[model samples]
Target: MSQRKMLQLSAGVLLFLLPWFGGLVSGELSYNFSQCLDFFYKETPPKGFHAAGYQSICQRYKNQYRFASLYHRQHRAPLYSAYRLSPTDGKRPRTSWMYEPQLVFSHASPEMEPFHIPVDQNVIDSQAVLLDYKNSNYTKGHLNPSMHQGTEEDREATFTLTNIIPQRAGSNSGPWNRLENEVLRKFKAFCNGSMYVITGAMPYTSGARWINNRVSVPEYIWSAYCCPSYSTSLPKSVKSFFPSYAAVGRNDRDSGEEIVPVNVRMKASMRGYDVRRMSVETLEGILKQRLAVTISLFQGECQ
Candidate 1:
């Protein structure tokens, strides 16, 4: 056989053997996010976040670093995903979801692999599987939305299960969706340089919620961004949003209106899933209270 054919055969054999091989320990995923620092605003990951059962994944796809995710092992979801916004004319990579191999086997390939049948038990146990969301009445929420990515591969990389959370349909398609679009508009119109975003899931302060008793569902979704370089001539209404801006959307309307109040004027379906825009500092304060931990999304507040 030719050299190419031989290499392909070897890779196939390795995939076949990976599942049955019991030698691999399903231990802690220690992969660092340093390789993908370009995704962050100042080549810096969020700081002051000290937590166990979390893995820093430098999201790799198609042999390139696309983004970074702070994945939570126990929740089977990401704490947050950070990426620099890029303009895109690409469509969503629906039905082409993938999972992180490094989460299962430490020595496995770092690239996100498309979901396949007969998924290994280790893989299912390590992170959220497709089965967890099927008929669960919750939508697969993208922490790093595909519309924010510039290239097709970058969009596809956001579909990884590690970067998803169980979200209500109302929030996914309603106010939260609008918030994402608004951010994109700001990037396209005002931002002269990189717009670094960190979107995350916020758990309820009381207790945890789950889908299929496996993947944890977030009570609220929060996002923040830092854009240091932008047009000097800005509208008064949007001027406060420059440098850094943030928002929190209601995943469960019944959860309460303290963070984001319901817009009674809207149609019934979209009324409760309100997204409240605020300053990055305000969002940080809310996150610090909810998470019981201090996390600085930008380096020296994007200094």
Candidate 2:
């Protein structure tokens, strides 16, 4: 081969390999919430919901970003996942669980998918994997549900362990599910503008609860939404839900009813862990009392 031709081919190969080499050198690139400031309303996340040991993670999956979360390292779970609801989403994406590479190692920038890359100890703790759910009564519950996203990619980004919490099957598949559907229906029928949603879990009052000593189990799972614009004429049944709404689902059926009152009429299987819908202020009140922090989930209370 001519020397000139060899030089040109070598240059082309170098250009093609640069990106891969850069990724290898930098490790993986994971993002923080500040990296995607546009996703939040006015570039402002929730306030007064901080904890001592929690770390903030901005979830990026398959190059499609979705939301941000406050992850509790010791608990091996998320305190909450915040996302803006997409109105055009039609179907859920077929995807697997992913993890934040930076959580376990500082060298990585982007997130990692276990199927695409070998599972590494520096990614997530061994107890945080999907295998932990096996033979367990609890389910891997999502704080930021995929159904709220606008596209398949955005939906798929929600399936990360940092966005999951240990939830009882009764709450995960029953009352909690109903609350999600109700929120979806309201968002579809009433909301006319961007909707900001934040879902999180509350730890037990006395001490930390654990699943196999790996993941922390929450005492209650709570969710709230703020829609700045919406239909003026709402149905009487849902009239109170406009602008903002919140609900708390019980993780333990045996727990007291000071916050979320269980429905006595529900069947045996779905009776406990009932979800009670309330006003945004009311939800915040409960959260403030339980979390011991004055949480402001929306800007100016979505006024």
Candidate 3:
């Protein structure tokens, strides 16, 4: 063969192989939640939250601990993410959203590096590449919200999509945000010890719903906290919140009002997404009914 012809052929072959080789190097083949329990408190993670084919994720960022999540592959979103609430830190870390590398890359061994992987050319095609919440009506709502963290790094770790779900603007900015703040206040004022929290979603009963066919849109968002110890002298207003409390917030306006009743008197913007706080048992009852499984958020019901 002529030298020029050989060079051209070699170039063409390199071009053809780039995409495949790049994918392999990027760790696209091995993205499941096999090591999700590492983030759980005492390594004793919650039970009965896993559905058939569920994936667990221990959210890490730059080797900094963040939170843990249980992902539903079929729904293409997180069922829940658990984290211990750290005392409030005033500094908010700059938003640099990331994805879980272990979810997409086989070479990206669990706990080998920071849990959050940067977006690059290699992982552009993986299913673990989550949808960007740009130009969309829905917000990229966090299950482990940043407000509950104590340090800038811990707050920033909550930005990863593995710890987020598609939530309504009303719920994310209004009642749900209020609920998170309230919980933070209680944790700071009353709890003298670590407070374990698990926040998750409840999909529609009949079928799954997706946002832009890329992410699951939950029917409702629920959260529960277990504080084994707290101030003995509690204010009457928040007396019932100590030890444990749970709440379920509506995500859709058209859904029935059985689990979370909508208040007709509230303004239109906040009317449909009311968050109803209840005891841990009540939340479990609702979860059992919706998820069709025995749901236990805390061991011994936080004792």
Among all candidates shown, the one with the greatest TM-score: 1
Model 2 C-alpha lDDT per residue in residues 167-266, reported as the tens digit of each score = 9988888999989888888889999988888898887887777777678888899989988889988889887887899998999889999888888999
The residue-by-residue lDDT of candidate 3 on 1-303, one tens digit each, is 753344323311110101101122223211222234334433455545322344556676666556777664444567788888998656667776676665555567543233245556444444334444565578889999998998887888887777778888889999999999999989989999889998988878767677666666789999999988999999899889979999999999889998889899977987899999999999988877776667666767887
- Which portions of model 2 show Cα errors greater than 4 Å? 1-32, 49-52, 88-90, 115-118, 124-127
Residue pairs clashing, model 1: none
Scored by lDDT, the top model is 1
Q: 65-106, model 1: which lDDT tens digit per residue?
A: 888887766678777888989998878866588999887878
In model 3, the number of clashes is 5
TM per prediction: 0.88, 0.84, 0.81
Task: Please give the lDDT score at residue 204 for candidate 3.
Answer: 83
Q: Which of candidates 2 and 3 reaches a greater TM-score?
A: 2
Name the lDDT value of residue 224 in candidate 3.
93
Q: Where is model 3 more than 4 Å wrong at Cα?
A: 1-42, 49-52, 109-125, 128-132
lDDT of 1 at 284: 79
Overall lDDT per candidate, in order of appearance? 0.79, 0.72, 0.70
At residue 15, candidate 1 shows an lDDT of 9
Candidate 3 to truth, TM:
0.81
TM-score of 1: 0.88
Worst 10 residues of 1 by lDDT: 12-21
| Candidate 3: Cα lDDT at 11 | 15
